[model samples]
Target chain A: MKLRRIEGDLWEIPREGRMRVPGRVYSVGPPAPDDPALQQVANVAHLPGILRFSLAMPDIHWGYGFPIGGVAAMDAEHGAVSPGGVGYDINCGVRVLTTALEAEDVRPRLHAVTAQLYRDIPTGVGAKSAIPRLSDDALDEVLAGGARWAVRRGFAAASDDAERCEEGGRLSGADPSAVSARARTRGADQLGTLGSGNHFLEVDRIAEVYDPVVAEAFGLVPGRVAIQIHTGSRGLGYQVCDEFVAEIAARRGEFGEDYATLPDPQLAAAPIASALGQRYLGAMQAAANFAWANRQVMTGLAVRALLHALAISERELGARVLYDVCHNVAKLEEHAVDGVVRRVLVHRKGATRCFGPGDPRVPAPYRAAGQPVLIPGDMGRYSYVLAGTARAMADTFGSSCHGAGRLMSRGEALRRGRGRSIARELAARGIEVIARGKKTLAEEMSEAYKDVAQVVAVMDGAGISRLVARLEPMGVIKG
Target chain B: MRLSLPQPYEDLGHTADVGVRTRGATAEEALARLVLAFAALAAGGAAVAAEREERVAVEGGPGLAGSAVALLRELLYRLATEALVPAACEVLRVDAAGTEAVVAFGRRDPVLHAEGADLKAVTWHAARLEREGAGWVAQAVFDI
Candidate 1:
């Protein structure tokens, strides 16, 4: 696949080989000509009814069907919605929170706080949730209500978290009935649990402020301690996605167009108007709800752990949500296609929605500053806080890269990590780390990912999203 | 789960996930090795137990590759929902419509085992199964 530089960090793969539209990628440095991620971007262009370009964010990396950090919008009336596009981890996302404690406060007792978090918030394989197992009826409510359900059940640190979350943490059209018993069984006792492999809970400190106005709006202040949480819908989301992908694979033609024409089998999809598409949408939304509730519950647990470890009153801690955004999801939103604004289903796999300033969808308080976009980097590097921009709304379907994409495969990381203590290295850098798996720290070390600064630079250079603040992890926990 | 093992499978690397390439004397043999491969990877190098034994049956799509995927998904479901990992998998039947096998199981012991990659899903990305000479070979990837 050949790429033509379109100016700045933007590049294009012109329409070719059954493509419905051209493919666009935003990156300072494009991947190799034969990179599978570039081909996946090109493949997404071949799907039925894809509009404009099948876009790839700067942090794009190869994934099953859609490239991670890939985005594509399809015509609501004619396009197909692929389950692989939403990804297996439905609503796999990150949330940034502000705390009243200063950097000095956390640094002195980072070990204690980190230990408390590890104890209170379960991590790793088969680590049951800190929250008690839910009954079927309770699980149904969780499937239906999302973070709002968690807040009502007293699981969120802030009651208004739903208002500050993407889709207010509860997407409409979620039908618990669409969820399978197998899926329910898988999710039964898994809520609020952090599973292994890149899932983490970190304690951060505001290291630098870029857009002071927006940073202040989101309550970020230099030297103030903050927290970042990353996880997803757990087994429930995985099972639903597995069932649907297989469902589409088995009945390719029944969903309208012949999915046999897809560039990859994992790209199997259904028309939005098809019965199977609606069924998948319903189930996906339900799984997404479960993920939201999962995150919210974890938030409550983190706050509790901090309160106990720091020995501070809740009032003194002042932990509040900065923002929460889902990276993998499909949403019906209105975005301009050739200067005409109409509803389209945006498939954001390994991407985030960054609605620009003044968008009514943004929370009222931060509407002037745009949505807070959290970009958590590798454990030893810097994470960034960016804000949505009108430029992003106009050019990229209001989407941005989710993180510093992997630069090395897990196998390669493990090979390089042989006989080295990643934990000790991080400790040498003044960052504390813990994990249930011995090799996780190595596979997820800073060398495994592209420098986040470069990843965020592409977007900022292109005016997609502006940098707001930089966060440095003082302590980390991983599954 | 612990398996009495002899297998041919190598790690296949991707930018974001992990995969396997397995070879066997027959399609069923290849598929059985694939099942054990999932078990071993899910265990993340932890020793598996043979706490229970059961026959698992699955209705796949219209081909051998489809059945391979179906078999993988069933194992993942068992791991995810029941915390049941496979100690051994003996393929009893394999055809265009489905596959059946008897599997030795163990409760996934978090206390005794290192927490492994909670594989999100088994993807059809580059999933391949074909007859190679007198034997068969299969390949598949998992979302971590």
Candidate 2:
């Protein structure tokens, strides 16, 4: 694929062949010439009614149809929405909560805390949840209400927790009826459960504060403890995407012959105005809501586990949600298209929305400081908290990289990890971990991922998101 | 008749997910082996047993490729929702005109097992189902 450097940290693939728009990628340097992710980026450019560009972030990697860190904005009135663009784990997101305790106070009991979390929270493959099985009616309520359902159910401490989340923790237009019975059955027992592969709950310390002003605004202070939850809609979201991908593939002939010429069958899509498109949007929204509720419930469970482990009172814990952001989703937002602002469906696969300051969509408490972008690194290293910027709004559809993209495949990681003790290595660094699966530790070792610091530096240098604080993991619970 | 040994399936490399390529004397046999391969990937070993049987029906697409996807998806749905991994699959009937099929699957014993990575969904990316010379071949990638 041919690519031209547009500027420092940015490159463009000129519109060619059947492309509707040019492809833009943001990285510290140009991507490798033969990187498959670049081809995926170009493939996304061929989608109908794509606006401005099919974009990628610094941590781009090869994914099914859209690159892992891809961002594409489609004209809601004329463009199409593809299930592959939203990813199977719909609303796979991150949430951070600040605690009153200091890192020093928790160091002596790190293992106990992680052990308590492992006992309280479900992890591993097909793990049952801590919450009781939901009836069909209760499942509908959770689907419709999202995090609000958790708050109403006493799983969330306050409504403010929901307020600090993207879309206020509940996406509108969620139609529970649109969700299939099979999807509901898959989700009924999986709520508040963390599925395998990179999903985790960590206890982190504010190791370094990059910008004290923004860090303080986000309730971060050096030495303080924070909890991060990384998960998503689980089985329900997977089912939703699976059903739609098959449905779209079955009806590919209805979209005319142009659809037949698409490079990949996974890129199957329908115009945003079509009936099938409407059904998919409703179902996707419901799945996104399910994820929000899942996180909210997990947050409550984590707080309880910490309290029980530390033998502390609620007053002493002082656990409060900082923010929650979805990394995989499709949202209808108004963005400037060649100077005119229009509503478009922005698809972010393994990317986070980084809406800048002064945007009214930002929660009132964070309006002065911009949205807090939570980027979690691997357990052995440091993660970052960033503030959104105007540059992101002007350039990449207000998006940023989600995490440290995988550098090695799981099979390779397992092969390299043979005869080595990953847990012991992390323990030497004063990080305690508890995982149910034997291979999960090896598959998710820090070496399996890119240096997240480098990924964040590119975004900071590109002016899409500015650094606020850095967090180092103290204890982790993994599936 | 007894089930044969040394299943005709090989692991295929993917950047972030898992893939399998299978071969058989006919399209039905190829698909059945693909199902077994999926179970192996999900279970992380070859210890799964044919402890139970379940019947499944799928409305496939226009051609063999579409039918393969439809069949795999039904199996995936069962795995995800019911945790029913197929230790073996037998294609009972294939309706060429309607592009559908009925199959009997030997369910994996769920209680005694070491579960591997959760297979979220099957992808159409790089999926193939075709005839090669005298035999048939099928390939697919699963999102883990």
Off by over 4 Å in 1: A256-258, B1-3
The per-residue C-alpha lDDT of model 1 at residue A98 equals: 93
lDDT of 2 by residue, A34-106 (tens): 9888899999998887999999998888888898999999999988899999999999999999999999999
Q: Report the C-alpha lDDT of model 2 over B1-144, residue by residue, as the tens digit.
A: 112223667766566777789987877777777777777777676465555665677787646766777778888887776667776567654443223334334444444555456788888887767788899888888888
- Which regions of candidate 2 are displaced past 4 Å? B1-8, B92-112
Instruction: Tell me the lDDT of candidate 2.
Output: 0.86
- Quick one: best DockQ, which candidate? 1
Span of ten consecutive residues with least summed lDDT in model 1 chain A: A252-261
* Residue B26 lDDT, candidate 1, scale 0-100: 83
* Residue pairs in clash, model 1: B1-B48, B2-B48
**Native contacts, share recovered per candidate:** 0.89, 0.59
**Per-residue accuracy of model 1 over A1-479 as CA lDDT, tens digit each:** 89999998799998887888898998748658888899999998988879888999999989989999999999989899999999999999998889999989678899999999999999987567578788999999999999999989787667798888988998898988889999888888888888888889999989999988888899999999999999999988988999999998888867554466788889989898898999999999999999999999999999999999999998899999888999999999999888899889999999999999999999998999998888989999889999999999999999999999998999899999999999999999999999987778888999999999999999999999999999999999999
Clash pairs (backbone) in predicted model 2: none
